[model samples]
Target: MKDYYEGESAVFPLFLVTSSDGAAWSRAMAWLFPTLLLQALLIVSFLHLIWDWFQKQSFNKQMFVLVWMRTVLGGLAAISPSVGSLEGMVFMISEVTLSIHMYVLFEIFLQSIVQAGIFLWLAKRFLILQRK
Candidate 1:
């Protein structure tokens, strides 16, 4: 393989942003595409699994809430930028599909870490209400 430390290769979007010096950008591009593809695949696969689960299981409030949240998060992710540049103007470099995949993963991660307690409390309340 050719050395990735060479030139300012074009990003997929072609006009999002390019490094003037070609140092950090070059390294990032080397690993960026493949990683993005893998990430997309994983996200899509997980979404498909969730869909399948929905199809097989009987409908319930808890499942409904979980699936609804996932759907909304996935929708947000679908519009996410794989990488953005703030140099002068905002630009998105990643494809929509890849962007969404990555965003979903990130959103879920943040939700888990940042709102774990709140989510647990809400889930408990929801369960209690559902029992009545």
Candidate 2:
């Protein structure tokens, strides 16, 4: 069996599982499904928030809703994967796999935090303008 990281050099990072075996591919998909689902949900929620804003909803309300949704969904996505196994099935259980999962979780969490901060700042500015 060809190792997923076969023929890789120090100059390049292994970003994907290159193995051709069915088990490897299945394992990759199992790990990827939830992440993709959460991302799709986040995008849909964002679009809905934009629609609400265009509909003349209160800016503060919209900001709060967006931030809340992002926080909840982002946290769920971050903790959804087991890293070592899924439903008693082990897939690509290796250090590289673990590293990839950690990287993706961290990225999701960081993006959520940044977006929430930006939304809060915008809400504060809107309130100030409304007061004036």
Q: How many collisions per candidate?
A: 1, 0
Candidate 1 ranges with C-alpha deviation above 4 Å = 1-18, 53-132
1-132 per-residue lDDT for model 1 (tens digits): 011112444333243334544775798699899996786567446646765554465435435445445444433433543331122113443332344445445566565444434544564687699999
lDDT tens digits, residue span 1-132, model 2 = 133345543111243454544687688788797986787667666766676463365655655555555544544333343322231123333444555444544555566667756756765698699999
lDDT of 2: 0.53
Candidate 1 lowest-lDDT run of ten: 81-90
Q: lDDT (0-100) at residue 47 of candidate 2?
A: 65
TM-score of 2: 0.37
Count backbone clashes in candidate 1: 1
